[model samples]
Target: MPKGVYKLPEIKNEPIKSYAPGSPERQALKQKLVELSKGGLDVPMIIDGKEIRTGNLSDIRPPHDHQHLLGHYHQGDKTHVQMAIDAALKAKPAWEAMHWESRAAIFLKAAELIAGPYRYDFNAVTMTGQSKNAFQAEIDAVCELVDFYRFNVRNMYELYGMQPNSAPGIWNRTVWRPLEGFVFALTPFNFTSIAANLGGAPALMGNTVVWKPSKTAVYPAHLIMKVLKEAGLPDGVINLVYVGGKEAADVIFNHREFAGLHFTGSTGVFNGMWKTIAGNMDKYKSYPRIVGETGGKDYVFADVTADAKQVATALTRGAFEYQGQKCSAASRAYIPATLWDGVKKYMESDLKSIRMGVPEDFTNFVNAVIDEESFNKLAKAIDDAKKSPDAEVVMGGNCDKSKGYFIEPTVILAKKPDYITMREELFGPVLTVYIYDPEKLDETLDILDSSTDYALTGAIFSTDRVNIEKMTSRLTHTAGNFYINDKPTGAVVDQQPFGGGRASGTNDKAGSVFNLLRWVSPQTIKETFVPATDYMYPNFLED
Candidate 1:
């Protein structure tokens, strides 16, 4: 690698493989899952490139079968987080000084390994450990994960090439430097792609990170670390440590070197972190970058002219995929009064057809929610809804946690537009439907906007182009990712550039150039072709 200009091959999104019945990928995945089930892994915390086996341990298990032991992760204390931060700062100079092309090669190699050799391992771990079906696993761990690596590198290259314009007498340029201190990446348990992107994106841009992934997602998150190491990532660049939320914050937030917080979690947690960082601002060398994607009460609005089948399919897939654990999941839906019966009929039929069970069986489309806490919360919300007068369970409210944390795909019909379930985020497979009068389309949009504080992902279905245009204009600030005729959950990397604004996040779209910008601080450099020793201008002297 040299100081010359470089060009990478044009980037593209990795194609998703459907592990249909009797397919090759399907067979390979099943074999891998069986092999993993025989023996679980022993996860360890890696600080300064050395594995630290803390005597304290936490057992990892599949959400669908809590009785089945998957593995154990070494728990970390507050001291471990402090050690990781120190290690990241120690590794900063060399990694930041490394040539951009060399850094680019590492992530590109990682993408190839994930897409080719380690694909099965990642897919299997996500399916068995995270309780996602095979297709869900492929879309998350295999396809979108690779997309993040490819596009993130491309983004860095573009960002570095954007040198500042110069005057005739001087040469000017901008240097993209890594943050002054370390970044702390806090990931969620639902999406493996998100877990990989949260820390990897910053590391790719020459920033060292201290990663704290969710306990439930440690299975696939561990495998991701292996891929990065095998691809020639240097040790001590990104230290992986697992500790409790309070323990991590007590050390990370108050530390003077905390440069940024890259997070994908709940709104409550993000808000609290923001307040802590603001309160402790004087202790840090520089203002920390706060980038996060939090909770979303997403929606789907269908007009009278919209196709009934399309509306039904969107509700089924958007509201129930991955057990409705996505931040962009369609939790509240607005349908026209005239087409409510047809849409409801289609939704009920789809619910009856969707098979619910463990992810090991490829036939099952729905799986369990993440953990016991999530399961209990969803169960309580459903039970409360059933007892309320404003809401009725249209179909699928059965819940049985004796074997696993499984909640049937439940749909609640709301008599009032501003029902409680429609406003709050439940983070499960419970959707609320409210039928709006055809003449009150504008009023319904207002209600949707005022119902929840979050503005993440949303969709609209209408055959009339006039109504579509009107909704697009009137509801411009309602959602960050707005779909015309599609579901809200499936946001592609290059095409959609996913993220949202308001309560959802900072609206820094991930998997795009904008996200890479957050990790670098620009330094503008100015040069003079000829040196000038005189202090005063000739015009001033003559005058």
Candidate 2:
């Protein structure tokens, strides 16, 4: 399996299942979801590859049915966070010494396990834990996670194959060295795939990791650890820790062995971590690699030539899917005055048909937001919008949290383009629209580019080829994944290569080689085939 001699296998994306009604896959997932919600599962933190059960227990419940307990996890303190870091550092020497092919095989096998045997378990747990409908769970846990594992394996192989061009007298080569110290992976709740990939990417690149998952995503994170373990991932290579972000910060950032950070969460937290790391920079062995994906005030724009149905479908799915919890979900839209009336009519009716309830209900498209904090934030935003003179609640703006944290699909029309909702990241199923004069298409692009601090994902709906090219060129820095006549949500792994810049993230492009590159430091290797016993060369000679 040595590079340059051995040919790497072609990699393709994992197919996404529709999980339509009455299908065998849907039926299987439904049965698993019911079993998971019975409330008997126990989760423990994996420190030194050994399960540690602290007395501190945290109850896990579905966001859509907050009254019922789905499971309980043992919480760890600062001691556990330190233990996990120590374990990862202890395991690094041996893990990094192992053959690259051996490391790659483990993740590829894990991908197969998720795509086949454990598919139902992964999807079901994601649905019950995150309150995602069947389709959402399938796309995220089953498909996207599989894609990250498989595609990342290919990326590893391809990266290793890169060698310097050699001349007749000598051979030059580059060896990708894993980071010198342990990496920390802090994951988020919106996508289970992210929870898996954040740690898995560093581990596959031969760097040991201390993974701390979001509190809301512990259930699915547990299953991810199980799959990786069953796939024969080496013990201590990737340790799972259940500790608060601050606890981790106190223990990890000060350690001389702290090498890198792979994070996906709030911008404020990432910024804070950056400041802390920089403050303690003198105490560390090396400058840490900080890669993150944060908040996005993402937007969508439609030209007068675009189809009303296309714009309508894009808005309905883009703004509301997964309860608009996606970092890339369209929060603001700029529509031309000519297309506003028709796009609005279709978009309103489309939102009206969406069913909001528990994820267990197969037909429900809208589920509750993650927790009460998120619910309150969204509820207040809607109330403020309704009271403002510059904004009009065009569609649903109601919220009732007695049973679960539920907020109906909402749309706000802003008289001015600079409405608060248009610029801030609501991170809920709320879309703010700003109607623009069709003649000022160029001016609207300028507004969209500067309105948000984050540059994550965006879309442009236009039938005109010239205008499409112009938008693509002018708003190049607005998003990492820019869509043409498509919604900004649902960024496919490998194909879309997700992440963004500015306040959004480092734009590592998670499913591509770029993200994996950050986990390693490359070293050049050169061999002199001929002896250079004489110090003098022809060029240096007096000839």
Candidate 3:
């Protein structure tokens, strides 16, 4: 382990309890889920008030030790996809015609429900299904989702203006409205808030959504649907499906009614979606809107003037939190050569102090990865990095998959900033560190800029005002969410708009007015108070 890094808190080991099957606390959850299952709330593939369930089904497993079964979800196929498109077509007219205030009120109620009695269920599913610790799960499943709901209500009114235009004896006005067709949302497993934001945002903006959530997060997605239904959202406003990547791609790419795609996942998947959308452009009903937030290789730069303790804490927490699965997780660190020795000592000591264990324990700071596949991926990456001549594992390259997908928190010291370990997105409890000359800050920034195709998030730590200004300005193009004294994670909704640019994504900043605008299509409507009395008004005829 690295020298002076603090150990994470320890967790108590005990048999995991199911919060949904029979517990008293789960009575409401069970009733809600059962209600949803029995058609109290609508499922996916409903068109024109008709419920269409495709025979295809798939099992979804909670990642807490990978032994718990969350339940099964309908796997939407081509026919179901078409049905969803048709349903959106049927509902769009009436939904869009409703007063915006009514739509906003539904979303506000949903937020209230999430913050109320259902908060625990949301957090529970997030912890078990996504393998996140309590704090991380709470932030993802509760706080962020609530914030998005509240923020976007205001954003809707802001993005869609209501002012009227006037001229000499003439009046005109313009209105922003939802797209004419269905919007598809492909969400990731790392964040449950994304499921709501991607689908709910569009739905609130008067666009019906066909959402395919990650199989690992099915339970939470279902709960979100329950909350929406209980909050008084009409049936067919948002449809939920659970399927693998190929199935989702088939539905998204081939459907003519497919108006757009909102995606968050791997770069390979994002690129593939882009290609598929482009290839089938001629088949779509209208020009499709593609908004995505893909993979990221974010970094944290530590200058000699930076506080050693603060830098250590940020680097350690950013890299190990959520098993380092977040898109904005700090995967690499660049330290000034002059402070490398001191920073290394501090990080090592702190790392040694970090404790890791199962999720139920409130004191447990780190939990398992999402599943065995992710664990294997992290293992392979660590093995490859260990073999590199210029790199050494300072701490944590161990994995025990006998019971759970557990990997020790890991750190690597690199000889160069351009090392392979520093260039890729590890997406695990692993971080790579590089030492560079402070005077070559520009050179360092250039290397980082070109190292990876991702431009999601990055941070710089320096007390020098000149250095801070210079680095911020020069590296502005390198990241979407930039930070000075803070870590890349914990992005608050109202304060910092999320999402990325360049290969990372479309730069549609989530949690802001801009993100809400993506779901709406602005239309200019003009009306004249008086009809034209004459078609021809020549200069000689003018009186």
Q: Which tens-of-lDDT digit does each residue in 382-411 have in candidate 2?
A: 999999999999999999999999999999
**Clash count of each predicted structure:** 0, 0, 19
**Which candidate should be chosen as best, given lDDT against the real structure?**
1
Query: Could you give candidate 1's per-residue lDDT for residues 1-543 as a string of tens digits?
Result: 347667897789898888888789889999999998875679998888788898798998888899988779999999999999999999999999998888999999999999999999999999888899999999999999999999999999989989888988899999999999999999999999999999999999999999999989876877888888889888889889989999999999999999999999999999999999999999999999999999999999999899999999999999999999999999999999999899988988999899999999899999999998999999999999899999999989989888789999999999998888999999999999999999999999999989999999999999999999999998888799999988999999989988888999998999989999999999999999987888888788753
Model 3 spans with C-alpha error above 4 angstroms: 1-59, 74-76, 162-165, 530-543
User: Which pairs of residues collide in model 2?
Assistant: none
- lDDT tens digits, residue span 232-273, model 3: 788777877655678767866887878888888888888988
Query: TM-score per candidate, in order?
Result: 0.98, 0.98, 0.88
Model 3: weakest 10-residue lDDT segment is 7-16
Q: Report lDDT (CA) for all predictions.
A: 0.92, 0.91, 0.78
Candidate 1 whole-model C-alpha lDDT, 0 to 1:
0.92
lDDT of 2: 0.91
Worst 10 residues of 2 by lDDT: 1-10
